[model samples]
Target: MADKNTQVQLARQPDGEPKVSDFQVAETDIPAAGPGKFLARNIYLSLDPYMRGAISGRHMGHSRLNQGDLIGGRCVAQVIESKHAEYAEGDYIVIESGWQSYCVSDGAAKDGVRKIDPNAGPLSAALGVLGMPGLTAWAGVEKLADPGLGDTFVVTAAAGPVGGTAGQLAKAKGCRAVGIAGSDEKCRIVVEEYGFDACVNYKNDDWEEALKEACPDGIDVYFDNVGGPILDTITQQLNLYGKIILCGLVSQYNRNDDNDFAGHNMGPFVGKRAQLLGLVVYDYYDQMDEFLRAAVPLVKAGRLNFHEDRADRIEDAPAHFAKLMSGQNVGKAMVTIGPESL
Candidate 1:
């Protein structure tokens, strides 16, 4: 066993898009499992846009993190030592292990520890496709929006884990899945890799026109990720009685204050009679088995696809996260902390 644990900690709160200087790396004594807790070695750390708001205390359920505090994140881990009855040594699981190489947890609900299905495509996938991002997509597609055959589904940030997974799920249900992404490369990945029918590069001068061309009948379902003018613009083209899943606000995650978030124009929504649904992934944790049950087979059959961009060390997480926030990462952003197995 290593004598020290490496961690990425907050050095300061970022004003807008994060900078690598905002974070500091440190080494500490590796912690041990207590009577009711288990010690796990983190293998992969999931980097997400929400962490921008989370560290700044702008995101709900998370308080402001102070300097020297470890940045919080989800991780795929292998239990190396255990005193907890439910978790045994050598178990592969996903947990809220933060951005550290090791963590000790009580296997509590708040810790978000979940055993990995060996049949799941890959260990890193537990942090992406078969994990929280996937669950978020599943809940929105299956539980809320529920678009079916002949429905036109449009998603923003389409190259990402949530957007890509949601599009794939909608496609499986026979919906015409179209994606709107930042770059042509991202659009290519969305269409060719994730199997979306078409993708609009929002960076283009005529993306709105492209989106219109893609959804000639008007959009029946809009799985929104980047909210702001794009949301209002998409609402303009929405069909009457359409369903809109307001899944993320990545464009505004770097705002200095809650009041700074872009306000939406309700007039378009009213004209379209849009059924807007807010999605918070935490509410759907219990449905993991249901999601994996459906997702695992699709993965096995090569029907559902996922993409990842990874950093080899925890020290690089801040830079990777900055890239993710700036809309540069091609897929799910991750940092590898240790080997998947001991």
Candidate 2:
């Protein structure tokens, strides 16, 4: 075992879009597992748009990564040394190992530690479709939105893990699933690969018209990720009693303005009597087993398709995260610390 461990730290809070210089890598002595704790060698790191908020210092209270703090994120790790009764050496577990090569943990806190059966699915899936993003999608679509037959459901950032999974779940529940994505390629994958009924390329000038045409009956449920012009367009087309799931506002994550509209229009709230519910996945973490029970079969049967844009090294995390914020990635953005393990 190496004596030193590498970790990515936030050099400073970002002003707008994050740059590589905003982060700095450091090498420190590998931490030893304390009594009732375990030391884990991280294998994969999950990079998400929410992390942008941390770097921007806008949502610092909601994130573990703060100025000069080691960049925090979830990871798939192999236990190298164990002092916990349940976790053993050689066990692969899902943990909040942050943006580092290793982490020390105790199986005491919520989301702090959980053993994963490597044989259940692709280990990486535990970070994407089968992990937090997946649970967020399932909670919003199944538990919150509750789409039904004849309902028209639309999701922004449709090519992303949460949107993609939400659209698939809507389809399975007999609703008309529509997607709004940044590029034609993303739209194609959402429709052709993920079985979405229609996907609108929001990059086009006529995207508003296209989205309107796709859902002739009006949108019954809107799962929003990017809340800018896309949201402005959707708000105008919501049906009576339409439900809006506010999962994210990636379009405004890095914005400096506190009063910026970011495509927000409240006219529909009263006129359509719409229910705009903000989703914080942590609120539903206790339902992990419920989500897994529903998602596992669909994944095994090939009914649900998850797209992953992976970087081979942890050093590439900053670049990949920039791509994600720019809507350049096709699916879940992840960094692989050890590709050989996969």
Best by lDDT: 1
List the candidate 2 regions with Cα displacement exceeding 4 Å.
Answer: 1-3, 63-67, 260-263, 339-342
RMSD (Å) per prediction = 0.9, 1.9
Q: Which ranges of candidate 1 are over 4 A from the true structure?
A: none
**Candidate No. with top TM-score:** 1
Give TM per candidate.
0.98, 0.94
lDDT of 1 by residue, 1-342 (tens): 678999999999898999999999999999989899999999999999899999999888999999999999999999999999999999999999899999999988899888996567899999888999999999999999999798999999999999999999999999999999999999999999999999999889999999999998889999999898999999999999999999999988888888887577799899998999999998998888999999989988999999999999988998999999899999999999888766
Q: How many Å off is the CA of 341 in candidate 2?
A: 4.1
Candidate 1, position 272, lDDT: 93
Cα-based lDDT at residue 63, candidate 1: 94
Candidate 2 lDDT over 236-306, as tens digits, reads 89998999999988888777556754345677678989898999898888889888989989998988889
